[model samples]
Target: MTASPERQMELTLPMVPDIEIAAARAAGNLAREIGMASASIDEMAHAMIEACINAREHSGSQDRRIYVKITGTSLGEGNSRIDIWITDHGRGFNVTEARSRRQQLGAVHKRGWGLQIIEAHMDEVSITTSDDGTTIHMVKYGKNDD
Candidate 1:
């Protein structure tokens, strides 16, 4: 299949939760610009923020570094979709433990729901990591971007 036209934006953010709002705002604005509905934009923002928050909480480093990329295409006629990738350069995590924690969404914990929230809001979700770092990938499709 032929590839669709895509645009991408990248950001290198300090591994801090306070700065994630800008990422969400950027994602939301791009989603809207590409015809994503307001609701879908909100969902996209949520997913991006969740990923960033996860990086903030889990990534291990003296001066943590997070890399984020937002990519998407306008599918023509007011339809569009966007993919977001949040990457961190820190000590990786245990895939099994992380997966298990995500599964226990209602465990009465104050947090640990970021992964679940990301999965719920995005159309697709993928996670990959190694001793070097972790990357969380997610996508959202526009219903009526206008």
Candidate 2:
């Protein structure tokens, strides 16, 4: 497989539990096609799943949509990076606030671990919230240095 000079794909679908699997598969396929390392792709796929699960479980039940945009770029010589944006159309919350609350709870709940897991795996994680909704931007490092 050859990596495209420009590697990118966009997927938009209903924010439902079942659809997350499709998204994960799509992401993994892209990673392999673009020559991303297996371990990096696996971590990225997991991050995407966690983000989508949050959207499906915590977001409103109806009329909710998730948009996924993935871009793979050659950073330098052989190094590459993958940027993934997962946006959900639902009532927005402050990511920082939610994280703080979860931490302060001092209890371990699987539900609140989604963001933490995503952050831990990805090279960079950013959360943007607005009246429209919330967007989670995650980036993973690829094997190639250029």
Candidate 3:
């Protein structure tokens, strides 16, 4: 409902810890609305939690704000590609550096697994970051889309 659920959606959430729950809820609803399978919906929620957590901890947003946006082609029996954008206005880190750090982490590492979980779940993932903030763009296909 952010933008008619047709072309795109934009939502602003008060930058706060524990906001991931809200995100997961919204994602699950959208997935169901598009007739996505339960398994995929769960995966999307998992990724959303990781990303939202990262945004909360890393995105140095003094005002404490997080943004979620959804966009898709259509929802039905055919196929659809859903795109979600999670952004925060905090100090940004280099994508390459983050990946390298993740690669260097031990299997039992306690932290720094947000992006890793995200990349593992989503069909496509890309990140763009700068001093202004960080934005993670994640894509997933519907039940029959992939």
Candidate 4:
């Protein structure tokens, strides 16, 4: 079986209230087009929102902008997967330290759950950060192979 070419969509959003919704909607639409399961689509959308919000709130980007890219790749045999990347050009922080702080805060804090939420919803998640910027990469499979 031959795999189909990847389809990609990109969006650049300014740091603003309610702008994350647009990114989430775009992700959901792409997931749907790629035949991702309904539940997976919802999860992807939620993860997208959390990622976008984190970029906006934590990035401290001088440009005040976030770049999002969603790519759908066919795995052949009716299987597909969606990969998303969210990037911000700002002074990066230590993810490990942040996670440790969040764990320490636990239920007392009402915020700082974006990374956790994204991890819970996406099939796989990885983050790359440096003084230059941070980029979050998330992936979700279209079907439950198990």
Q: Indicate which candidate wins on lDDT.
A: 4
Residue-level lDDT of model 3, residues 97-137, one tens digit each, is 66765545456666787888999899999998989998999
> Which pairs clash in the backbone of model 4?
none
Output the TM-score of candidate 2.
0.84
Candidate 4 lDDT for residue 87: 97
Q: 1-146, model 1: which lDDT tens digit per residue?
A: 54474677888888765778989988877776667789888888888887888888878855687788887788776778898899987787876676566434456765677877888888999888888888888888887733
Instruction: Give per-residue CA lDDT, model 2, range 36-136, as digits (tens).
Output: 78889889988999989988877653467888898887655556778889888787776876666455455575357788889878999999887677889
What is the per-residue lDDT of model 4 for residues 4-118, given as tens digits with 9 covering 90 to 100? 6478999999999989999999988887776777888888889889888888988899999999999987786667799999999999878987666554544676788888888
- Runs in model 1 deviating more than 4 A are 1-3, 102-108
TM-score of 4: 0.88
User: Which pairs clash in model 3?
Assistant: 15-64, 15-65, 59-90
| 34: Cα error in model 2, Å | 1.8
**Per-candidate TM vs. native?**
0.87, 0.84, 0.84, 0.88
Clashing pairs in 1: 35-145, 36-145
Off by over 4 Å in 4: 1-5, 101-108, 144-146
Question: Is candidate 1 or 4 superior in TM-score?
Answer: 4
Best TM-score goes to which candidate?
4
